[model samples]
Target: MDTFRKFALNIAVFISFFSGLNAQQTYFEGVYSEKKIIINNPLSADLFGTCIHRITINGEIYPFNISDNYLEVDLSLLSIRKGELFSMTIDHESGCVPIIYNKNDFKFKEGVKFISLKADGNKLSWQSQSEVLLSSLLLELKFRDKWVKIAEISSNGMGNQNYEYIVPFLLSGKNQFRISKSNTKQYYYFPVIDMTEQHYKIASNSVTKHINIIKNNKPAVTCYELKDLHGVIVKKGIDGTIDVSNLKNGFYKLYFDTKEEVIIKK
Candidate 1:
């Protein structure tokens, strides 16, 4: 994977497509000192097959270079000076889905190279280089328009590293994830990864042996915590279903995503 240099982008604008928002966020802010806008498609294809997209910055067409990933635009060529306010947008074919890594993308060090950030189920996997200055990292999620710290990641304290962590509790809809160094004057962030969404409905409240969850009429990945009548948590996990065959017949409170329900066990 290639590294996109000097960052923090207007990421909230790019995620509107995935969140199914009717009106997209327009990125109209002063340009960062960033020179290159790099994107990675993550699909294996021939160099010649690389897609060519258009970028309109301040209503002017800006040209960029393409590679195995997505595309990289050199802002320097556009004659846009630092601190100059600019509005940018990307245009592509209907079937093409090119994410904006430059949008809402920024980091701590200029020498650091962020390789990639990916989401699988409820776990987040990312890789980075030149992390010698970092001691520990804090993972933050965008909630209610504010960035909130949810987990602390221990850095390897070495350059060129890869790591992963499973989120304890996640929201049901689209979420943005950001990472920052702990207890530092600078709270820089890497490009935000759009976290997974787990929207599920109880297949049944009459718990016979297992509680099933489904999304769009099929099994769905979910984050849930189950508590007994006494308000003591008995089970919690990220899975598609809950098993409670051994528990004695009684009423239990089921907590999932953003909803709570009272379930009857037979």
Candidate 2:
């Protein structure tokens, strides 16, 4: 049996505290394969049976009946494409809410472990713990709204898992990286921190004060957000020094792009 396990479902619950009532919030977990997929409920049956659960993919509804706390889907008859995204929902008299059920989020194949990728300056580094040797992989950078292919790297089968590639062109502000084999659905995102700097300084903590901002010559438009210790954003402005004279006396986090700095108000 081709078993895929441990993936979580996006469960949305609508609860009314005053009435001591809650709408159905289905928690789906477990295995999905070519022959069949099992969506098991991690919550009580009361929340589930209270609403109607349906799996809709590509505009087709595949109805299922809950048996033994799971919705078993037999794909032998359904013409569902492998690696296609789908959505789930619960319909009730109170409201109809949609849930996230993407096919790509599941691991259908075995022996494919995840690797870690990092970006420092203009260089990209990737490391894997798996002994499986990867031959060739494609690298793409997110530029504006489009994906730009930066490199197609070929690896020699010498059992070396750590690799690094330097970017030839200049990358402005912040960007994302995608590394995978060409034409395959198996791709991974490398989380990289933004290297852009926001030249800002808090002048004073008095009732009336101004922040000083030094502008840099970068093409990308930068935005700044001032967040409290609880991570609540108090104020936001375009990539420059913002006035926080009206804010409470406490420590605040200054966020611009992927960078963060802590500031205090007396």
Candidate 3:
């Protein structure tokens, strides 16, 4: 007919403009200062560092350390990262907490060190070039309430396009904290009730440690064991004491030994 209906309407408008540019939805804008945090990823050379950035207050997790001028992030925690978009300022000399990122679609994959996230059933498996294939990749899933955001994936085979976001936390019985990239600035204190008596007394923010208590799901107690002067293992059931005082401050997770402590209840 008329040239095959204009070649099927020009291949359906070029496959709907290449599926709307692969579903697009990756834009981040920033500008925060106290020392630095100015991000304007007009796709900044297509995601400068390659992506592995992080920021989460109420739930912990705060990892971002790109350098060159600045990009520290974590001003004292306030809950950030809703697809990125900020503008802050306050650098007085060495207050340090800058943050800036417009990093286009994000990408960063060099030698590929580690990227892992697990949870299989509803789906969530993203492993990097190697971590033993991270159990085999299942990809995509984000719910975040009790927590659930597994392997957001992105690697392109290492050239300079690495993006790995793995999140999973639904251990209701509690105990799964994570936050320690460390420059200095820590606060984690939880004790309302549940130590069954072993002696009590806590408050030494020298970056205290050791405080994991999960009840039912497992792991009952352990309290006190701080470390992070570069000693690495930041905190792990510092001494062993949980009475919760009464319970009602909010946020908790202290698994001790194996590692995993993030507490707060004031």
lDDT of each: 0.60, 0.50, 0.32
How does candidate 1 fare on TM-score?
0.37
Task: Give candidate 3's root-mean-square deviation (CA, Å).
Answer: 22.7
- Predicted structure 3, TM vs. truth: 0.16
Could you tell me every candidate's TM-score relative to the true structure? Answer: 0.37, 0.30, 0.16
Model number with the top lDDT:
1
lDDT of 3 by residue, 1-266 (tens): 45544654564454334332212223233322222334432212233332222223233333333223444454334434322234333211121223345333322212333334333322333333321111222232111222222232333442122333333222223333321112222311111112132222333211223233444444443333333333443333223444454544545543433344456645
Candidate scoring better on TM-score of 1 and 3? 1
Of 2 and 3, which scores higher on TM-score?
A: 2
Q: Score residue 120 of candidate 1 by CA lDDT.
A: 68
| Per-residue lDDT over 73-149 for candidate 2, one digit per residue giving the tens place of the 0 to 100 score | 65443454443322334332234333334444444332233476787777888864432333567788765345667
Overall local distance difference test of candidate 1: 0.60
The global Cα lDDT (0 to 1) of model 3 is 0.32
Model 3 residue 172 distance off true place after TM-score fit, in angstroms: 3.4
True-vs-predicted CA distance for residue 191, candidate 2, Å: 2.1
- Candidate achieving higher lDDT, 1 or 3: 1
Worst 10 residues of 1 by lDDT: 1-10
